[model samples]
Target: MERGFRLILAASLMLMLLDLCRGSTIGVCYGRNADDLPTPDKAAQLVQQHNIKYVRIYDSNIQVFKAFANTGIELMIGIPNSDLLPFAQFQSNADSWLKNNILPYYPSTKITYITVGAEATEVNSTSLVVPAMQNVFTALRKAGLHKKIKVSTTHSLGVLSRSFPPSAGAFNSSFASFLKPLLIFLAENKSPFMVDIYPYYAFRDSPNNVSLDYALFESSSEVIDPNTGLLYTNMFDAQIDALYFALAALNFRTIKIMVTETGWPSKGSPKETAATPDNAQTYNTNLIRHVINDTGTPAKPGEELDVYIFSLFNENRKPGLDSERNWGLFYPDKTSVYNLDFSGRGSVDVITGANITNTNGTTWCIASSNASDRVLQSALDWACGPGNVDCSPIQPSQPCYEPDTLVSHASYAFNSFYQQNGASDVACSFGGLGVRVDKNPSYDKCLYMTTGSNKTLSTNATAIPTTSHSLAGKVHTSKSSWTFMISFLLFLAIDSIRGW
Candidate 1:
């Protein structure tokens, strides 16, 4: 009886630890590349107001650090890429950096991780990355704060030579020399391997091949990686699994993966039409829901993931494609680019511009006019297959089948899925394959379902139903704690009985 009690106690403790692990926090990246932005103090206030507990900044600015002090916010600070070579060449430089930058306001501001440099592997002096990290770690140890702060660096998905199958992910041959030692250091020190992943880039580079629905994480169709037989519902999971396979190949599967940056832009150039406000809101809002649900990637199910959205505010001076400058959740004026609740309490309608509160009672979803045949066909298969969109009306002998074209049939199916999914932007976006409209596509004898056409359609819509992928449920943490306490009491009772 005593042994059984002890076993239950140990199991309960393990459950508690796992519960803590799965309750990871969602954070935002605080970038400062623009001239017309609020002061650091105000920015801190903004985050606090939004109830964002975790934040990542590119550099250890004094003003920003001071603002975060006593705010109960956890921060991950950075060292610029330009300083990597200098820090690597001399330990004294690193010591001075820690003394000046960190030792001043550490516990007050809660500095949890020190990112050595932002995407240092991309710079010409990539070889300096590991040495700089080592020096930084040594400095932290010398200051007696090594346990409080972890040292690491971030990488871009560009470092991977191949990421399609995910299982076949391999680092670019050129970066192997630096990555080998770096991975070893990370494993020894128990630091997470941070990477920036953007599904938008994949779609932008290959729109014809990549499904927009998959990129947006709204697809019912799953991408099965033939190599690993792992089913991927969205590009984000595929990207993470790609990194996981890469690490496993290198024999460093133990190190955790954290996303230092990932976000969709709200505005873009002419060709980048997918970068719209509705799309951005949909992506970010859905991402929060996915994280809060504690649903890890297909490769690492049930494990918690730590992620930081690309930026806090959009910067006007940033260089590169227009999308590069527009990856911020909030504009420079400190106003949100769209209605997004970081706390995971906002409605999906607020995000998709559906204005669920005041509907006109006449709306339907349809295939976008610009949707290509290939994209349409992919969405059609998903709707008819996994999405379970009714297709009897679009069959050969049915009234809606008179058109018989892929577009006509697909439009009907897309509308059915969209209407069934609540007519939100997320539902209509079959990866840019579908759109919502007010006019009913129903013709004589075709009878397309709309708000006015059928009460059954409205009832079946499920009124902003939570995502199919939602992992939200009771964590059952307290159950284990209580069980441990009860088991201990039973052990005491058994001892008393023996004495009697």
Candidate 2:
């Protein structure tokens, strides 16, 4: 019995280790924008109970930080936007903030990065983010914690005036002044430009324009960007690239951007009555997929964007929009809000190890994002194929994407969007039509980003047809000299006619 017990124990340990490794990634943003909720200690337990290994919070709540200590739950803490001016003014305050909130509870608490602000450039946010981030960096350095901890801020999707085609990325020129400096900081510090992008919002706000299939991450909704002529089945990538377009326009194309806060509210106020349980599950299902399966964006193929979903539990105390308090994976009572599974993740059956590699929602985000092929390809065949989105938005004179093939038609609809308010080259290297990923890898050269990284395409010229025999060898090596001479004469005649 003792030997059997030992064997079982050893087996269990190995399994637990594997589970932990898998779950190490894929985090949940634990936003406490509300005043009421569970205490830090209890909340920490609640997070663990769900087997989520990563947590992102808006403020460096001591209780929350302390609660997660030694739990191996990676954390991302933040500073309020209002504090930006103060921290920038006094590095001492930063030092004090760290000493009081960070230093003492660091390694034990697994405090990872320090977000300067939560979507600082987003709606209703102050414009002092750039200065605040600068101050935060300086203070972190003085405290000797800059290297160990990253300093950055987040923004809202609204930062981009337009986002449709993945290729035509650009930012709102109005926000450009503040965004330019912020992008530089992120690039310099090796930090990510965070954005709070919600496809649900797009769907709700522009229901007539945004397709449900696209927002829901369903397989059928086929969206094509005209600028690059790349096809997109979902809206998440489109939203991210809009930020990319904005950054690229400002000449900050190299900066790596991430989604800091994104999610669909399970419930909503009477005005936002459209919020439903099913939609929430679908949004999360697809969102989790893009994060885990490493689906590349239409602009940057193969490059995976880091994402943090908003909130672990519903905050009854949250104010304002009803949706504000509904973006939780769980309720305050420690029960799951919905039954959507990421990577089919759930602890109900047996709580042993982390199963976190975020399988594309066993039910949600399953289109080009991966694993789940739930999209009914036949159903969406038409919308994504050709002549779908009514182009009352783009003016007639604008040189837009022409409906060619199924791929070209949809890609063009989105590609013509001028967020950065300009265009460079419009060449179709592949048959002079279809999507083209800039093949350059070096810094000076901008490879047209297409959902790929480290050799996105498996092989080049796959579609081009060619004969094995060399034309020159075949013509010149002909056994009959007379025939070769005649061929050469014909070639010369043809060249002369072409004015060669």
Candidate 3:
């Protein structure tokens, strides 16, 4: 009994540690294929100000490397397809490239992954990818930086021949020879299989078959796989799970997947009606929330899925359809095309204007009138407990304590968690017990907090005696500390039981 108890405790602690150590997996791809984009220094500042910690650049530009230095932002630098032949053909060439580009800024710049080529399968240069990766790895090994920086390549969805129902996902047989060796190399090196996924293209090509709500992660219905009986709520998860099944079928189930590029366009040509600002905002916002929340696909629940939003700025030079040039979250001037909470704590509504400035409109989370008292109480406990919401203001004799009702208390707690977490729809969703409203919920001497701009609501009357609370100073209970406390208590209880 004691051994079993100890085993359970160990397992619990390990899970908690895993949860606590997991950092933000969401990143933005900085593609400077335009002449009007801001300088690397200014771009880096803009990214950092928005709380974005991870960035992926297409090349190892000296200016970009220097700009990101000491910013503590993790970088995934890339090598274009043009350099594949030279790097793959000669080890000296790869060494020279890394020496000139990486060695100087690494450690300081926090360069994590070095992608050799992007979309090699589409370019018909599949043969050069593995060799280029090996030579790059060899160069890093010689520099003693191989362990710190992983080497890999990116692929488009065109590599997969079949991706329906998710369970039957498989790679095209024509590229099996290329993929088998590449998969082996990635598995052996513990590198991720990077792929660019775009649900927008899938929806656009076949609107009748693909639902817009599913593509944007706003689906009210679920699609169940007939064979596996696995349910899919959105196109993104289905697409990812299809990739997972494909990898598993090839006997490379241990290999992890990374989304190198994924995003929606805010503007498009006349034919591209779906490519509106609202859809873009919804797709990117939901995508960030889905990734950062670690809501893994049906095939791999609770897995840490790292994703990079495609193209930081709209590139006018990009050739192809009008939507191709509009996948950026920001314009060339570093202004957002729409409101996006990159921190993954909030929701973004559709903005309709040219060169519009992003703003956090008045929004508040309150208890749903339709929800039962029991549900509200349960959500209240979670918000105040694990959610780490400051609930003192709603206590007895406090400013917000009037009415002393359960719904009233839950509203305060829910809104506190919501605003503290970026005023996001997901933050307000306390298992359907919370509802968001535009009207202020503040009354009497009680004041409610808003998004960063307007900190709190003010009334004409004088304030009541209350303990001040700053959302910035809100203390979170570390998972490790909770684990230790529980373990200690369990150990004491076990000792007492044994004595008895």
Candidate 4:
């Protein structure tokens, strides 16, 4: 009996460890800025159908709060800039707001976070941010709900005066007065520093320098941060690392960073060639996979970072460029803008590759940007040796050797093997370290071999086609990917760059 009991305890402990390794559910922001959106109840139902457990609304809409009641969905309510002054001057106002907007819907609605203001530092409402946050916290504490719901605010990436090289990221000197007190309050309260990170904006503003693949999380080329010697494959990780460095500079290293907004627009004005349904689908799908994989940024490896995708439905009335109103994953009628699985619990799906315009006979397979060096090396060894692929092209004297990093070399060899073996998923995936692309990976003098025939590649073992919006007969067999994977593989935690 004693031995049996001990075995049961050990099994339970193992299960707990597995649970910790699971990927976190992805969250979405619900901004009701459009006139044609579905009703609150309909939106809540749509969220539930998508298996999304987290949602954030821009304001404390009573209808939205009531809609989420008993839905088991975790919510984050926003306090707009308009309420900042009132909440800052009088804690009583905050108390009243919470009483009317929060307390009544408490446990049933699952309010997990309350954002005091959005883009406070960049907007004119900078002065009231800290005071407003403090007042809200005080009100929550008085009502005995402070411990239940976290109080925080979101800032735009514009808060950083210097973001290049990531390690040099720092808040603007002009905003120092506002940030110093805000950081202190956040540190004391154990609230996360929320920031809106948009790589699309960066790419659109300066397409000459930023690699489109890097911004879209589809790049095999690694951007090494010179100061930290850390490898960054995607702009999202680079952006977060910049914020991490900025926080460390402020002596607030322990304050966790949460992504309040990060997404790609499906439509944009003429100049914004990068924004399209294909690009949006690619960026967001890869993002979901990255999050579920549990791979933290290069700065903070193995850490679970909470993230919320920009908006739920496209807001037709939003101002700015065309892309501004097209960030939503869903249309106004509750239909998905593109095929996406937030839980990341599906087969390995590959959207548009390097070129979305023309994908026919040619296909290129390369190393997954998300995989670690150790994993890439293991796969690289197999691809060069027993995989029966030509790797001499990646040697020191060869052209592909210029940017000769582990990631670059491995990608070349992996593609060689993939092209040689029919470009099938099984041929490319050297222990899950390969990704098949439809575009050429060759550049300059380094020529990657590609499949010339127009033979249709078998999709039997690859991802299922998920473009359809009608879910009348579809079935889900696997567990939620968010609840199973450990971390993303893009940002590997190099031993040398661990503490920097």
TM-score computed on alpha carbons, candidate 4: 0.70
| 1 or 4, greater by lDDT | 1
Q: Largest lDDT belongs to which candidate?
A: 3
Residues 288-403, model 4: lDDT tens digits = 66775567789888656677887899999999999999999999987778877553433322322332322356677778888887767766765565343447668879877878
The segments of candidate 2 whose C-alpha lies over 4 angstroms from its true place after superposition are: 1-25, 33-36, 122-127, 271-273, 344-500
Q: Which window of ten consecutive residues has the lowest lDDT sum in model 2? A: 469-478
Which candidate's TM-score is highest? 3
Candidate-wise lDDT, in order: 0.75, 0.57, 0.79, 0.75
* Per-residue accuracy of model 2 over 234-277 as CA lDDT, tens digit each: 88887777777777777776788767777889889886755778
User: Where is model 1 more than 4 Å wrong at Cα?
Assistant: 1-21, 345-500
Write candidate 1's Cα lDDT for 1-500 as tens digits: 87677667656755654454335457899999999999999999888877677899999898999999998888999999988888999999999999998889889989999998878767766788889999999999999988889999999998889988999988888888989998999999999999998998989999998988899889999999998788998999899989988999888989999999998999999999999988898888778767765677888886667888888999989998898889998887888898774544333220121222223555667777677775567667767754545587788888789788888888888776665444566666665566677655655566554421232222222333221211122221212223322333333343434444
User: Model 4 off-target regions past 4 Å?
Assistant: 1-23, 345-500
TM-scores, one per candidate: 0.69, 0.63, 0.72, 0.70
Weakest ten-residue segment in model 1 by summed lDDT: 469-478
True-vs-predicted CA distance for residue 319, candidate 2, Å: 2.5
